[model samples]
Target: MSATPDATSAAPDGGFTTVIGPRRSLLAIDLAELWRYRDLVLLLTRRDIVTVYAQTVLGPLWVVLQPLITTFTFALVFGKAAGLAPPGMPGPLFYMSGLVPWFFFSSQVTKTSRTLTGGAHVMTKVYFPRLVMPISTTLSNGFTFLVQLAALAVMVAGYVLAGGLAWSPGPQLLGLPLLVLLMGALGLGTGILISAATTKYRDLSFLVGFGVQLLMYASPVILPLSRLQKFPTLLRVFELNPMTAVIEAFRAMLFGGAVPWGGLTYSAAVTAVMLLVGVMTFNKVERSFADIV
Candidate 1:
C-alpha cells in the first residue's frame, strides 16, 4: 500500500522542502537573509538621510557645520582657556582629528540603540529582520561621517598651506579604513546590546545620553593620551577603553605620532568579542521585542 506523503515533504514543482518552525540555532546571523533584503536596507538608509534634513534651511550643510562649530568650541575652551591642547599640534586640528571619529561612534551608538523602540510601529505592521533597523541607521550615520571627514580634509589642506602645520602621508594611513570599520563595529555592538536590554528596561534610553557624554570625557577626545600619562591609573583606564586606541591611531595617521599597536590589537579583540555578544543577545531578545517595545 502506498503511504500518504507528509506535509513537510518536498514540493512536486521543485526539490525544495519548506520547514515552518522556530529557528533551531540560537546564534545564527542569517547573512543570506540580510543579503536578500539589501534593497530595503538602502531604502531605509536613504530615508534616514533625507528625513534628517528634510525641512531645514541649511539641509546637509549641517553635517559639516556641526563638527566645524564643535572643533572651534573645543579649541577655544580646551586650547585657550584650559591649556589642554596637545603640544605642537594646532588646537583646531587636534580637536577635529579626535572629534571626527568620536562623533561618528557616539552618533551611531545613540541612533542605532533606539532602532527597535523608535521603529516599533513599522515593525508591528510588517515582518522583516529586526537587525536591519540598527544596521540601516549605522549606514546612514556613516554617510554623515564621510561628509565630516571630507570637511576635515579640506581644513587640513588649508592648515598645510598656511605654513604652520606639517602634513605627511604615512603607512599608518593605510589603516584608516580598518580603523573606521572597527569603530563602526564597536558602536554597533554596544548599541545593539543596549537596544536589546532597553526592550525590557526603558530607563536605559534616558541614561544613554548622559552615558555617552561621560564616555567622551573618559576617552581622549578633548585631552591627549600624553597628558594622561602623569596619572598612570587614569591612562590605563583610557587605554582599556577601545576608543582611546582608535582615536590615537587616527591622529597618528593624520599627523605624526607613535602608533599604539598593542593597545589597538587589544581594542580589536575587545570589539570582536563585543560584536559577537551583541549579535547573540540581539537575536535572542528580538524574538520578543515587538511585544515589549
Candidate 2:
C-alpha cells in the first residue's frame, strides 16, 4: 500500500499546505495586493472628499476660503500689528504661502489620524491591507490641498499684477517635491502611530484635535522664523518640529529665496526614522485589531 500522505502535502487541486509560524516583525507590504485594491482606495478617497464638502453650500469653495481667511487674519495680526517683514515678500503672499502648506500638513494629520476609527466598520469586515485607509485619507486631502494651492497661485498673480509682489525662481523650487514628501511622511507616520494608539485609548481622539490646534500655533504659519530672532532658543526648538523645515522650505521655493538646507535635512532624517517606527508598530498591532478594535 502507498504510504499515507502527510498534512503538509499539497492537495491534488494545486493548493499548498498552510503553516502557522511566529508573526514577522516587519510585514512585507505587498504592493501587488495594494494594486489589486487600488479601486477601493480610490473609492474611499472619493467618499472622503465628497463627505467633507457635502452639506456646505459653497462645497469645495471651503478649501479656498479656509486658507484665504486664515491668511488674511495672519496678514493683519502678524504683518500689520507685529510689523513682521513677510519673509522678504509681500505680506499677503508671505502669509498665504505658509498657510497653504501648513493647512495641508495639519489637515492630512487630522484626517489620516482618524482613518482607522472613521472606517472601523470597513476595517473589521474587510480583508484588505489596513495601510490603505490612512493612505487614502492622505490622498483625499491632497486633492483638496492642490485645489487650494491653485487658488493661492491666482492670488499670487493678483499680488504681482498690483505691484505688491516680486518673485524669482530658485533651486529651492526643485525641493518642493521633497518638501511635500517629507510632509506626507511625517503626517502618515504620526497619524498611524496615533490611530493605533487611539484604537485602545478613546481619549486620543480629543487629544489629536486639541494637539493639532496647538501644533499650528507652534509652527511658523503666521510668524516667520526670522521673527524669532529675539528667541534664538525658541527658534531652535521650532526647527526641531520637522514641520518647521517643510513650511520654511515651501516659502523659500515659492518666493525664490534661500533654502533651509539644515532644517530640511533634519526633517528628512526625522521622517525616515518616524516612518519606520510607525509602520512597524502599526503592523504589529494590526493583527489583533479586529479583536480589540
Candidate 3:
C-alpha cells in the first residue's frame, strides 16, 4: 500500500508533506477527515469480510449458522436448565433477540480493540486516519449482524405460525436505526479505549475476551431487566450499563415487550460521554503509537 498523506505541511525543495500526525487538539477527531478517506474505509471493510471466511468451508453461511448454534446453546443453558427465558415466548427467540445485537456490539469491541496492535505492520508503513480501521471493523460487523438477524426472522416466523409466539409490532421498531448507531458507538468507544491501553500494556489484549464476557453478564443479555427487579441494587447497577438498553430495547422491539425508555435515555447520555472520551484518548496516544507498538 502507498502512503496516504493526511495533509501538506511546508516546502523544502518540492514541499514536504507529513503522512501521519496528531491533530491540533488532543480531543479533536475530524469527521471530515474520516469522510475524505471513505474509499480506504470501504476497501478495509471489504478486506475484513473476505479475509474472515477466505479459507473456511462454510464461508458466509457460518454467519447464519454460528448464531443459530449459539442461540440453541444459550436457550438450553440459560433458558431451559437455568429457566431464565422470559415467560410466554419461544426460548430461542428470546435468546436470539438479545444475542443478535450483542454479537454485533461485541465484534466491534473485540476487533476494534486491535486496531493499533493487530495492524502494527500497516500502521507503521502507511498513513490514513487511524479511526478508519475501527470504523471499517464496525461496518464489517454490520454484515454479520444482518445475516444473523435474517436467520432469526425466519425462526420467529416459524414460531409465530406454530402458535408458540405472537407478532405484536410496536412503534419502538422505528427506532432500529438509532439503536444500531448507539450499539456501534458504545462498542467502538469501549474497543478503542482498550486498544489505546493495550499499546503500553499488551496484557490487556489477552484479557479483552474475559472483560467482554463479564460485560455481557452485566448487561441484560441472558437475563431480562425485569428478572432483576427483586434485587433493586443489582437492577440499578445493570441499568447503568449502556448495553443493557441496547439489548433490552432490541428484544423489546423484536419480541413485543415494552421498551425501557428510562434506561435507554440514560444509556444515550453514557454513550456520548464514552465515545467522546475514547476519541480523545485515541488521538492523544496514536501520535506515538507507531513508535511504541
How accurate locally, in lDDT, is each candidate?
Answer: 0.86, 0.79, 0.84
Provide TM-scores for the models. Answer: 0.93, 0.90, 0.90
Cα shift from native, residue 56, model 3 (Å): 1.1
**What lDDT tens digits, residue by residue, belong to model 2 across residues 61-84?**
888998899888878887888777
The model with the greater lDDT, 2 or 3, is 3
lDDT of candidate 3 over 1-293, digit per residue (tens)? 11236434433334454334433687767687688899999999999999999989999998888778988899889888987877777778887888889889888889899999998899999878899998999899987888888898899899889987768878878888789899888888889988999998999998998888788888877788778889999987887778998898998787667888888898888888878888888887888888887
| Positional deviation of residue 255's Cα in model 3 after best superposition, in angstroms | 2.4
lDDT, candidate 2, at 47: 89
Off by over 4 Å in 2: 1-14, 17-22, 85-87
Model 2 scores worst on lDDT over the 10 consecutive residues at 1-10
Candidate No. with top TM-score: 1
The C-alpha local distance difference test score for the whole of candidate 1 amounts to: 0.86
For each predicted model, how many residue pairs clash, with residues at least 3 apart or on different chains?
0, 0, 0
Candidate 1 residues 207-230, lDDT tens each?
A: 987898789888888888888878
